[model samples]
Target: MNSAFSYNFPALRGVQGGKEYFVVMVPLRLIPKIFLFDEEEIPPEHRSQRILNKSRVPDITNYMLENSKEYVFSSLTASIDGQIEFQSFSDNPNFKDLGNLIVSLDSKFLINDGQHRRAAIEEALKISPELGEETISVVFYHDYGLSNSQQIFADLNRHAVNTTSSIGILYDHRDQLAMLTKEIIAETPLLERYTDKERVSLSKNSPKLFALNHIFNTNQKLLGKKKGEFISEQEKTFLKDFWFSLIGSMTEWKQVLDKELNPRELRANFIVGHGVFLEAIGVVGNYLFYNYPSDWNKYIEKLSTIDWNRSNRKDWMGRAYGQTGRINKTNQTITLTANLIKRKLTLPLTEQEEEMENLLKQGV
Candidate 1:
């Protein structure tokens, strides 16, 4: 490391909500030097106020590498704990004006937020060195002490909320599964009117029976599509046909589609209206399409015989519902539900499915 560490950043100084801070565009190459990640494992004697999540670093690094040219990140929040001097070319440094902020080599910079992004950038640069030329915005505040730094971290994260999956699908044009889900909802008669478009879960009294996010995820699982993978036209058509045939065999779904019943009533009375059952249907359909494609429709009749109402405790309680009668959506429950559907259709289980059945029998 160079002993004489100095950076002259063109910055704007402003007061936000009664606090003064500087915003500067920083090159990626200088990020690691200027900001240090306060990991959880660091000893208390050398620890800063910030807590770094090392587990998240590798995923963020992989995302950075995968979407290098198309990625966008929000501004990083940092605190400077040393001599900070601001030199203004203008006559009044107090007003909003262009200035040069300089920091001494002895200064300590601590990140209050965006430590994962900083670590990811460092790791990404090792594989793609040209990324060093890219720049990210950094917001700097003068550090008072550990207390103030901790408070800053708390205040910054207090109101953060993650984006919902359904909204992500609705607005995303990059994911092929999302596009296919939208098309299926538009074309499939049973799903057309009862699919919630903007949320991941439905309210009990909501007119919609299922969430668009669930349908997208189900299709992804059925088609064996990973995140960021493309879907072919044939696969999309197959998904449409599979969902149409499967829902056609579901009598309750048909009643709702034919205006003989209300979706809210169906949602209240049956488990089939929920996303978990739709996912189970997708799993069963995927299995049949792969193993019994020539006569997959012949097994569709089995879905009608299986009572899908939540009140059918003998059939659904231990498989789809917990002992308390609430729906269980764990992977174990999903596999068990698919196993029940498979047994009803007289379909043979794969090695993994048999293992799942054995685990269920052991009360797992």
Candidate 2:
């Protein structure tokens, strides 16, 4: 009865930078009502935070809608712009931080860092109202001023670094492509020794040949399945066979697996040892898999006939290496490299590849 007509939350108080802040678990249903978002045009310098990117909202909403039952959101940082009252349950110092926070209905609540999440939650609730029953934690700071709020937003984002793709794939259990990639690396005689599981870019002297996410992405191109899509045993067997036969045909990779060649030396000397080639192989393998299933291995065997030496400028200049002589990693380069590999393997190029090849010949 006491909670009516006002915003009341059971909160845990904490101190940061000598200022009191509170953490509260807010119900999704109350989110849109309690926090305010203004879409009206405001200059960036005057606003408390950057403008809401409307483009990012739908994707976030879809993710929440798809995984409403299991989705996780980190704590939203917000600023309460009114004098809110906090009542402690006990006078004991140990219990002083446990309290009820009450704010007048007229108080202004502004999100400092999670506007996208707030927007997504609102959209998700519209479609899956049951999701509104769940809660998201919000860390509330007493608003000093708009400048302070802007500073808070800056502080929150300034230190943020995105989780690396390789580590994310390594830790993901729900993503089928990641799982299959991990399984293949764990089991494959060639990849097991040379796969870097956590980092995307291998150090110049590192023994590892490729990163985990690169392998996962190559699998994505190889299988053309949605993220987290289920894999049939037959499909899994075919992928295993295809990759095994493909790698077996690469003599240098075998030499590395057999410790006859240093991984760094191979990565330095040939396009075959670069991760881009894995993607190119995946592209070529994907075309062969769906188009010429019975003869894919036969074509893959022809991989051995291609000279992969980085010095082969006629074959590799614009495809595997840039005009600057550095290895190329762009999607365009990967496609061009795949097209060259397809030709060497006596496989017909797809129309798209042929067009790209024509453009390459035209020096475009």
Candidate 3:
């Protein structure tokens, strides 16, 4: 028998101020691919709260092992008003990043959890000095004190109380969404350090558009079916096909963008449109790939013949929904809008183009 006994999953939902709440449990596996330290170089704090160094780091792993089954795979709501700070503890080594994670002597700086990850951060810094300056999650307890923080930590530590609610579902979906964003950012050297707040803001402010991008760009295996739904291995292969096609298509659009658009204004588009364009590419990429087109530019010329916008907005939206949008229904309006965007990429734009009419409204 395993050393630990069976325990229920933790309740992700709870109440505060007489109001019921939930915190979504986003499995690490579901987290969108992000750049992480090499496993050997990961800090102790960065290790899963469930495993590290034969349990030398701390006992957070024990809780996960014994009670992960009981933890509700849902969202929880707690008024989160703390900051994530990463401090380095080094003795003036030539490499600033090789230092340990330093928390000030202030009891307020006590770790709520994730000590191993912190250690890994130090190790990463040694190899890549730029990493020494990254922010990590933590809950400050200066005002609340150790007891309150510990209670918060204990609740987080508890793995066998899975009582999740509807709101919990939303939170969980939101987290999955965030993980996807992080994965994309990880690949872009220019955008790696973008804050979670910025990423969330971009998605929420334009949920439908972003969702369309996610569907078109992500691997099918990585796709989230809904809050708490487990991803299957088959879907992952599909997602890979989708990601490659989408990236290839973006190469053409980026050239178009460079000629007439301010890159920043198009940030959301690049974020969202990359996926939509990829879907369009997938629609025709197999043909192009097999034919061995000598020039990508010629392929773009060929793509220009396909007019997605020939259908009315409502009908186009219906198709997008029927296809990629079906998995996790975001907003149909945004989904439809994204399809039109694909048309703009593949077809010629009239001098008085459709995009001009909506661009201002969308803050694009």
Candidate 4:
């Protein structure tokens, strides 16, 4: 293969399983022409390629365009079936690991993962050709025929796991709701002491009162904030005051705070102890926050009057606990549970809540 017709990159050489791999930074413009995700999955081997989920590509493309100034993406993984060579910059031992990696233009490239990102870059380039100068990294592996490449794909994905929602909320800096949720936890000693900052579901004896994601989501409900909306300092203060006042009203939570009751048993047996009711209470607060303004704390105190036992069949059967005798965590259950709270507090129900009640009464 002629050097003039080869793809060239300043690549960092690495080794794994006693084989060579190279990490190269590629200009966005060359990615589509070189990888060609829309074309077919290759190695031209007898193997099934994971179909590109076309719907997902548009969202990723939009994300790139919207956050062009500050967007971040992980390196893409690819396998190259071509003649390859590395040209060292100098005889200096330090320069040995840094060099131009050259691959023949006739080589076939196979994406073992990140097909959506590749497709998205292609779509984005059509609209924002100026972004062509920007670069993305690719980790390239030498294409070994059918069996070896298949094994590489399997090993690459076998141990992969999606980050849990709570951890996502914990680490996200851009979303206002996530930041607000973190502030709420940091400001409240009770939450800081008992919140599960990583996982969503808590084991019965895990000693956590709420998951970080639950606090994030319910606060979104409380403020009626849409995605990407900014939270004002005044609103942040209101939420801070609201949580403290609301926590003050819950006797069992206070019991846990004072160590009078076991948090494990409380979480195990009570509706007030769960995030479902926090959301219901948040919905109730949305009305009170907007309607009562100065007197919402008094209305929040009314929570003390409700029985929070999971065994309260008449109140929780279809609200927090479903017909299956298990706690329900769906959005419908959150609203239905809010309806029950509204009734207990003698607060008027929204037309939508009334409609939901009517539908339930008619068994719809």
Candidate 5:
């Protein structure tokens, strides 16, 4: 007789590709005991799925523990390498479809996907034992062998794609900066109508000058704020005033607002229509606000006099545009453009800015 332990779980039986599977909800406390990672190093001859990344386990654990109240996870997928049996209580055919799934404890259950979540749940339970009461959905498939499990892993991840940053910002309400960016974009004159709502970068033929994420990042730089940092009402007001004043000083922006110039014409003719210039302007604004809070508006007049045309190679070639005639997004280019704005405004550079200037002087 085979020595075995058995677990009976309420399950729904389903079939796909002529194979049987079970969908079951298991309590968090039982996860560690039922599913094994088999995380040891394997030689090439015995290798199955890619080796588990132990480094990522702690981060995922912390995410689960921190967001325990609001956290949501998709179903965990696993495969069992033993016989499984199902029994139903009622005689009705519909009732027969819903039954208790009994799996031999002697069966080897290996996670084909969601090993990170499995690790995280084990870690989280160590500190927050009460979480054991919560349940997670699991999909169980009978395992054929190593090659089948490896194929399952490959098939699971083959089409996975991450959401775009602009779309993330557009939908995120948890981030204060993203929230403020949307409001600010809605209020800014030319920006309100011309900003791309769901992309990080715009195509040459795109009608918008800025992407939602670009505007959010530029505002973050402008206020010297880190991502997800809280913004005070005073800071919000200051940001609004700063952007309004800066836009007011740009003759081209005013022309577009007044319908005197087409947006495409401005985009084709100037570097200011790109994200690099906008972010550089934000960096300059950040410096001026920190150093000259009471008189920063005075420098807005000087911005109008600086040539912003993209064809002005002497001013833009090495700063905003590279030798290949495309926008260069390197930090060096942004700093160089900010330095040009500082020079135009006659503002003294900070020690860090001075170092950047010296680096550029050395042709680095």
Candidate 6:
């Protein structure tokens, strides 16, 4: 069958875990009949062709006019070509004139993968609903499963930059944190001495560490297993905000550490004490904001006194290694510690800090 008229298969299909190549192929007549778009799936770009900022390529309209006549889709079985072939109707208005094209199929392809190609084709069909163009090159295998396909997906997606994934959201939120810090520093340029990385690091200290350490040390919770993976994304967001808020409250505390506390020595102390503190930060932080606000900073400062170079006693039956969990607990604990340090250094706490401390103590 011709490639152009072959797309009319059932929209959904399933594959098993075995290894086999099903001779699934497209028929010519079904291609033109396939509807590319519905109401909501609008095309994203005006032109299908990408603009080449550093190259001499003309704009989309001129590029299409000059090259459309020579364009050809490659066969699925042919040697792999690096060129990008599929383009939307809006990208090159002349894409419609190209007749049916052949494509090979792969066993484990998903709609999420073909979104762009599908979008372009759909837009073209919308503009000229009656116009007939059929067949697309597809190849398929049966029983060929996900592990093999994951590599293809990863390779195709290596440079794709997933802006929608949970990690992406975290990264973007970090940027927002940086921006907010910049705004704060504009008002008080004293913080300009700290790099973005430094500011982010300082913002993460909170007192939940003390509570979590007590729980873990008492064998009340286990953070090492593959448990709690479901809320991982939400936990991350919570952590980001918790850290940012703590860091934002640290202006006076930072000054005290700079003057009397020795940040380098204090940080070394934090890194060492984290093993016992990890559980507290993740488990207790959420509740303690209103539960133990009064002495949270004081507890952070106390915990920071634990010497990292000397302490190696295991916390969970020697079940875990490294200090990540402990270091991770520092956000809330350290925030509390910084506040205490400020008190000792004659820096009065802000009204927000005082109110927060009260709410935390009351578990409000």
Provide the TM-score for each candidate, comma-separated.
Answer: 0.89, 0.93, 0.28, 0.87, 0.86, 0.29
| Clashing residue pairs, backbone N/CA/C < 3 A, model 1 | none
lDDT of each: 0.82, 0.86, 0.36, 0.85, 0.83, 0.34
Misplaced by over 4 Å in model 3 are: 1-181, 188-197, 201-224, 251-253, 256-261, 265-330, 334-364
Off by over 4 Å in 5: 1-4, 38-67, 88-96
Model 5: worst 10 consecutive residues (lDDT sum):
41-50
Which is the winner by lDDT between candidate 3 and candidate 5?
5
lDDT of 3 by residue, 1-364 (tens): 1113221112223346453333332223312122122254656444322333634423333323333344221221122222222222444654433322222222122334544544443444444454333333222222243345446556776885543332232243333443444454455332333222222123434422233233323322135244324444444334344344343444433443345543333443343233343343443333333343343335444443333332333444343433343322233333343445435445433344455536534745
In model 4, what are the clashing residue pairs, if there are any?
none
* C-alpha lDDT of residue 155 in model 5: 87
Q: Per-residue lDDT for 1-364 in model 1, tens only?
A: 2325756788988787787789999999899877886767777555545566678888788878988879888999999988777766688746535687887778889988888899889988899989989999999998888778877887887898888988889887767788778888888766788888888888878988789888987887788787668777877778887787777788998898888988888977888888778778778888877888778888986789888888888778888888888786777777788888888888888899999888877887
- Candidate 1 is scored at a TM of 0.89
After superposing candidate 4, which stretches have Cα over 4 Å from the reference? 38-49, 54-70, 87-98, 120-130, 145-150
What is the full ranking by TM-score, best candidate first? Answer: 2, 1, 4, 5, 6, 3
Off by over 4 Å in 1: 1-5, 43-55, 92-95, 230-233, 358-364
Clash pairs, model 2 backbone: none
Task: Say which candidate scores most in TM-score.
Answer: 2
Q: TM-score of model 4 relative to the true fold? A: 0.87
- Could you say which candidate leads in lDDT? 2
Q: In candidate 2, where is summed lDDT lowest over 10 consecutive residues? A: 1-10
Candidate 2: lDDT over CA atoms? Answer: 0.86
Order of candidate numbers by lDDT, starting with the best: 2, 4, 5, 1, 3, 6
Give per-residue CA lDDT, model 4, range 1-364, as digits (tens): 5789998889999999999999999999988888844245544456525668898998899889988999888998988988999887788997788999999989988777788899999999999999999999999999877577667778888999999999888888877778888988998999899899998877778888888878877798889997568888878888999999888889999999899987788987898777788888888888888998888888888888889988888998877877887786788889999999999989999999999999888877
